[model samples]
Target: MVRASACGRPFVREGAVSAFPFDAVIFDMDGVIVDTEYYYLGETAAFAKELGLNLTQEELNGQVGTSHQFFLRMLVDWFERAGKGHLTGEEALIRWDEWAHKRPRDYQALINPGAVDTIRELPRRGVRVALASSSPMDSIEEVLNACGLSDAFEYVVSGEQFKESKPEPDIYLHALDLLGLPANRCCCVEDSVPGITAGKRAGLTVIAKREERFGFSQDAADKIIDQLPELLTLS
Candidate 1:
């Protein structure tokens, strides 16, 4: 593997074609990379506690693996409709960031284990790599940079760039267009239900990271995995 400074993208040393089942592997960021699902749980809970409201696992689940704009819209709408607060999306996000800073450590520091290794290993094995995350590009860059994996993929697609987020397949489809690979030629690793549905809708084999967040149906995925290392073993 040789590192090229071409925008920090990793280039595979000229190598033989691999016998992997899929020509490309599309990954969903957030929960899969930065453990942000867990982070969101804590932060949202903190926000709820600050307002004297109980945070339910189910409520938090709906916000998992969503775009920054999606999250902002969801939170702001809820608050407005509930007559709780009149904060704008930007203001809410600022409060969240402030809440994050007040903590002992930055949330970005808590990374999902084996994420980087799996990402690096994919390109090495002759599989094109892409990130089809529902996160906004800014959040994606921030997290990946912290993980030191910003340049590890051939493509990093954000949901905001597409017409819709996960569950609509637009994001994954856009990634396919960027990768120049057909849906059958690609596989997606996703940790959320909407993400899995989106990948499946795009006609790609969707692998689920075993998690119960978001009330996701276990049957939605083509396969379920317990850890990131499991991807390396997939053909």
Candidate 2:
């Protein structure tokens, strides 16, 4: 349970994962479970376009892994900057959610390859599984339900449940508390810099799902894997 360097030392090799050292595995939802990070940006850009605003990829990149509250505030600011009529963050969120729901993204279709199998197989291998996502509760439920994983996790937590999310470590710390396991006894699976930083700050071993499209750096994690099922090969 020693902290590895930013070099991201491998916790395991191409061997059986049943010998996995952690007591529990906490997952981040967006890019870890589903490739929604990309789609979310698309939705955001589309919504912004409807408001006569065009957001660059660089601007949308900053929104990755951030809490919904932070995203709403950013959206409000963007709207005001675009002369789209000044609106409160809450109002912007409501409008955004309304627009998003109208489009109705197919969560099942967006699920990352091997993600569902990885989540479902973990508990059978004697590893407890939980979800800690920055998405709101309703959105979390939607994804879980659509992915047919409503009962898959021992616990499911949302960033909206806390005063702050990711990079702040509050969400991860609360998740560890709820799991009743010390950080050393558990690990976090994440993809974004904020999520990895949160796990590290919470004192858990962070395994990042390597992401290249968003210009994210996975160097802060203890390990990096190309796919979710790679967890099954850990030691």
Candidate 3:
């Protein structure tokens, strides 16, 4: 068994490829790295309420781990249900974004416990790190920079660049391609059902950060951990 020391170098037995089992790790930003999923759900529900749409939390939860385009379509469907069918998905997204910007969240304060330490420590354990998020690149950059993680990942990919998002596995597959690692050689950290499904579909080990809220099921994940630094215990 290999173990990584908190402060010193990782320990490995003879002929071990590395202290960590995986060659690389790819992280998801929202619920896994930062505690922004709850905030986003709140914002989504509030925005719908302001529009008199009365969307339930369960309804907004459907948008979690989705691409920007998929979210827009969800907004359109929700609005149409509230008799606002005249508004297109794009128009609805614009309105929602404008509303959300009025009271912007401080992303730095939302960094999950041990997230930074875990990300920084993985490389020290002989693992390369990357990030793949359903967020647009601008949003990804903003969160990363705010959390003082601008240099954290060797590569960062956004689902906005792909034709499909999480549940479709395109983003994670693309991240694997970018890292030049096979899915079996890497793992993905995620908290949402769609993200877990994506990682599994991509043939990577999916480690879920336990998330009981938002009516999500993480049963599909290969492993579950309460905090980011728990990853250090693997292998």
What TM-score would every model get versus the actual structure? 0.84, 0.90, 0.89
lDDT per residue, candidate 3, 53-99, as tens digits? 86666777877877777887777877777787667877987877887
Better of 1 and 2 by lDDT: 2
lDDT values for all models:
0.75, 0.84, 0.83
Greater-TM-score candidate between 2 and 3:
2
Q: Which candidate is the best by TM-score?
A: 2
Model 1 whole-model lDDT (C-alpha atoms): 0.75
Model 3 Cα shift for residue 106 (angstroms): 0.6
Candidate 1: worst 10 consecutive residues by lDDT?
Answer: 1-10
**Clashing pairs for predicted structure model 3, backbone only:** none
Q: Give me the candidate number with maximum lDDT.
A: 2
Lowest lDDT 10-residue stretch of candidate 3: 1-10
Clashes found in each candidate (C-alpha, N, C closer than 3 A) = 1, 0, 0
Of the two candidates 2 and 3, the one with more favorable lDDT, higher being better, is: 2
Q: List the residue pairs that clash in candidate 1.
A: 21-235
lDDT (tens digit, per residue) of candidate 2 on 32-138: 99999999888888887887776788888988888877887888987897887899988888777777778978889999999999988887778878788988888
